[model samples]
Target: MAWQLHYTSARRGPTGRAGFQFVAETPGLPDGVRAGVTPYLSYRPPPDAPPSPDDSELGLFPVSLLYDRVDGRPLLLRCSYLGRDYSGRYGNFFAHAVVAEPDELEGVRPAELWHAPHWTHRPEPETPVLESLDELVPGAALDPEALAAWLSASGPGDPYALLGRLVDAVAGVLGRGHGRVVLVADDVELVARWIAVVSYSLPVAAAARLSFVTYTADPDGAAQRLVGTTPAIWASAQHHASHASAFDLRKGVRDGDASRFARTVAGCWRGPDLAGLDALGELAPLNDPAQEAAAALLALCRGDATVTAAEEGAAAELLSRRGPGIPEWVWRDLVPGVPSMGLDLALALHERARAAGAAEVARQCSLRVTEGVSDALAGASALAEIAAAAGVAGRAGVPVDPAEVSAAAARCARRGGGDLGAALAGCPGGSRDALLDGVVAGLAGARERERAAVLTPGNCDLLYAHAGRLRAVPVIACAVLASVGRRRPGHRIPVTGELLRLDGETGGEVDAALGEVWSEPPSAGECADLLDAHGDAMARRPALAELPSRTFTRLAFPGGDGLTEPAALRLAERVREVMPGGRAGRDAALVRAYGKAITAGPAGAARALADLADADGATPQLAGEAFVGAARRLCPRPPAFRAELLAALSPSARARLGARWTAELPGRARAGRAPLRGAEVGQRNELVEVVLRLRERGVTEPALEAWARAAATRWLAAKQLDVHLARSPRLRASLRDLLGDGPPSRGGR
Candidate 1:
């Protein structure tokens, strides 16, 4: 049946005047087919207006249609009231309405008949499916250019580089738009690959938002699940699918629902499977043996095993064909348990081939072994031995070169039980000491017992046990002298003493040797002794003088609460003793010592200093110095101290302290005295007044002001200043400063 729907253009107002009228159409309806219409007002008209008609008889305006004859097509009809209309003739009306056919509706299903206007229109376009990207830009063709560009531009201004922008844009467009755009295969792959890349590479905050979108878009996709299931994302989500879900997964897993986490991992593994493999490989080194073995096996299953069957077979065939004695034990021992057995087997085969007079087989095996053992310790040792033998034959009688000895020792150090050390030890007379020195130098810092064992007498005996060279005679004689002297207590020979006792320039050589062994800065005790016994020498060494004050302070303070008072008193004494010149030097030393003490424990040391300041012979100068030092150490740039110091003095010191102190006082005092109580109002007020006046004059010494404010606040809050400044104008000024200027004209009562 063709239906024509009528719509009112306007409604009745409070005055009871009729408004307007309009018409809408139901799709599949002929041009003149008539259907009754009704007005659905968002709010009802006033009681003075005319009574309304029954809603059932009038029918709903702009309603959807279900046609029994048509398999898929359905129509939507809408009607609205536009203002007052006087005519009822057959006039053309300009109105806004939506008419949709079923197949043309976006996101609409064809099974049932009814339709709505909200559905998006699905356009028929010929474009490649996303999966076709594999064939189009396979493998390396999809390069890192886009990724590098995105990463390079990832800072603030370029939002497109941010994963958040991409995620939000994708979500907004997908959720809001009614039309679809055709994406090229490259674009599809880029999007998919970019999602994978961002899941791993983006910063945590941006990645988190992107991960949410990915999971929300397709919960079943492997890549999405992997990104969602990562420890970082899972922790961020509070271990729940939804905000209301349980955070602890043990309950679910205990109830046999481990599938949730497991399936998430599996999903991640499924999407971009090779990327997953790469991740596994990257994490492999951190895994334990069992995990490594499992990962290696899995890698093998994934077709990335380092050793293959063809390589293994060739090694075995070569060994069988060209061995003097192909030991079955080699196969049973080294080959079976190892992961890269084929490579090791090939090297063994090459060794056998070389001994069996098979030149071609030997050459191939040698090449294979060389490639296989590039980083192996055994290979390095073998290479070093070959180089050393070649070196000795080319230049005989002269001492083996120090560089050759060093190289041979290093190879031996890397692989224990190798005889490089012995070979270097057996150099001809001229080269013996140089070679031994090389071995000792190489072995000096080595942690292994085997490397250090090269220095023992047995190894030295092999090189110089018989007829030692004249140069070697001194070394062997020295060792023998050292050994024999061990039998005597007071008669033991001293290497440095013996060198120094020699005549003429021989003493200079001893001095040089001693200098190499006993380099400077001495030790902490040596520095202390130097200061005690030879202060002049210490004064000459400027670097020693600049040692952190804490180093000396630590010696004075030692440990525990009981030591604080004594430490402070001792430190003051030390400062007086060492820094004897100007007040600036003494003051600097006091500040340094006080800083060390405070860092040792602020409350304890501060209390101790306070106690010391109150002691019997504590002159005001010393007391002031102590207080200033402690104050500076504790709050070096505190505004309250500056303010109080300014306040405690007249305008002269305030002027002297300058604009820095004045400008910083209010802010610093406010911050420093935040923990002080209201009881300190009077003294605090006085301090604040001084600080504000200073600030007005433009002094900004934060350290002095902070100290002054804190001391004054403590004193006044303790009721020490109530009688002194109860009725002062400075107090009023301080209060005004504290409260800030009165609220703006529009604010408060």
Candidate 2:
């Protein structure tokens, strides 16, 4: 890797100025037959083509960066210096050279590669000077002749700001028709220049198309290996304008900074134009993390003089996750315990994850967290997705609160009001981008299309809606949503209906989506119907069985329409066919179930009550208004049901009546036609029981009267009867035998 150099004099600005050159066939010029060319400059150049803005005694050198592929071997090293004049004139300082075997190749002359048809230059003022980019704007009146004179007279000033300014200008000037732009950052550090360029010139090129190539390990060794393998590279010298001391590849980056870098590139506007790096053709993201760190640091300083420790940590964490190239400084900041500045770094990680197509878990977690933020508590979701995406999950300590980030984003969404997209775009660094497109579509009523494309039909996807996933997010159905895996004891997995609108047009491709699955939970009977529909089919296809189980237990359809009513009826039948006890058959669970079912309507309630009475499983409590209606319906008489309604009144009702049961009854003799419900036997009146049973059996009123009289007289003859009817119509008719012979008066009792 020895080198031979030749010094060339400036043609215009100054004399005796030295710029070096290396021929491809110099015998020791780092291996070559006609080794294309190398522009890893370590020395200053002519005024017309300076190497860097900070080129003091000597600017930064090229590191021999190259694209492994190219079309021809003209191997051009074109250089130009664009400038403006004090007299308000503009022109370029241009120079070029083609490194070749010489005296052989045709159509290969660097001097002929001018951007425009012709070129021109002007004289300089005696003493030249360098100015800031700020001074360059308004009316860019700095020319190359004056710059060259300035370089020779003042001898190189700090190029940091200068080079940055050039990036803005170059992109605009030479940016047209180029979907892609390449910066031949041969100095390795020049990659920093690329990032700066991306920030300023993003208005010109798409981020996807903006990538660069770099040397791995040894630049010289790598170049040597490519001698016979890949085609020779043709490249230009990088015009890096930074004070040499400003760059140190050993430092690390912060997540905050990385995020800022990304944002700058994504947004652009307001500036000048100048071009040159096109000689670079195309380049990739810097292979070095330092570039990112450097760019981020620069951005940080630009925004604020100081950065927080948390900001550094976040950037470092994001960088470390991306690759092993992060220096120790980036992974952990020198100073710890700094509070977070914002979610920029974390958001950048998400953006990068999305960009690399490596963060489904991260995306989900992010969405889940956001959902949680919207819901005050972020409900039951887990952070597995975030961990997977950021590569810090399960690790000892990585302050990742997907929910917090999401909550902030939700607030941001609300703040924007009418235009969520604008809000998203305006958010500096947040997961809004990850969920933006989906949320926007969701709010626009496109969920159905998205659902069909992403899900399977007839299948609910509550696969992750429980105590640990898909918690209660406020904007769930608002289009933006995320979910997590959930678990419960002895339970079946459920299909959670998605909240956002589907993005795809056809469910044909949806794995197993179902639109109807998201509807409200069915009434008990409806659930039973659903269960029955899947019945044995569930055994063969367990999924069907699972669906019923979810409906019966796990799935909490919104409250209404008499939940589990049908199940109650079904269970009652089951009890009669199974249990033999009396009220024991009307256990607590049965009571609740049947009671709920009775609320459905009068007819259904009457049938259920009749069935219960036959099975001796009826409770004293009438379930609701419907049950009362059912009782009054059949009798037509004021005292409707003949099922001993008063006898079956729940204990609570009896306790509430206290002595009123007797007092109220004795006084109501005139209004003896009791409520449609049957009578109560106050003192173990067997006659009343017989008459009620007979009435229940459809006995006519006369038959009921005969039955009651016969039973009552026999009881009265055998024992001193102490009884009264609680809810019987014409109590005197029922109490005749015991009251007669005395001709009981309807007078004062």
For model 1, what is the C-alpha lDDT against the true structure? 0.35
Cα shift from native, residue 55, model 1 (Å): 99
Write the residue-wise lDDT of candidate 1 on 267-310 in tens digits.
Answer: 22334243543333232222122222323333332344453444
TM-score of each model, paired residue for residue: 0.21, 0.25
Predicted model with the maximum TM-score: 2
Candidate 1 has what TM-score? 0.21
Best by lDDT: 1
Q: Write the per-residue lDDT of candidate 2 for residues 1-749, one digit (tens) a residue.
A: 11222212223233423232221112333244223333332112232333334324223322222222112322323233333222323322222223333222222112112221111122222322212111101111223222233323321242323333334333332324222223322343334333333333332223212222222222222321111011112121113322111112122122222233333332221111112121011111323233334434333423443455454454445454554433323213311211222233434433444444545534543443343233321321322222232232212123335444444333332333233323333433334333333333332333454433332211112213222222233223211222221222112113222322233332221212222332333334544444444333223232232333233232212221222345645634443344324442443233444453335343444345444333333343323322333332332222332234333433333222212222233322213322212333332243344344534544424533443343344433223223344444444443554235643333221
**Total backbone clashes of model 2?**
58
In candidate 2, where is summed lDDT lowest over 10 consecutive residues? 130-139
Per model, how many backbone clashes are there? 48, 58
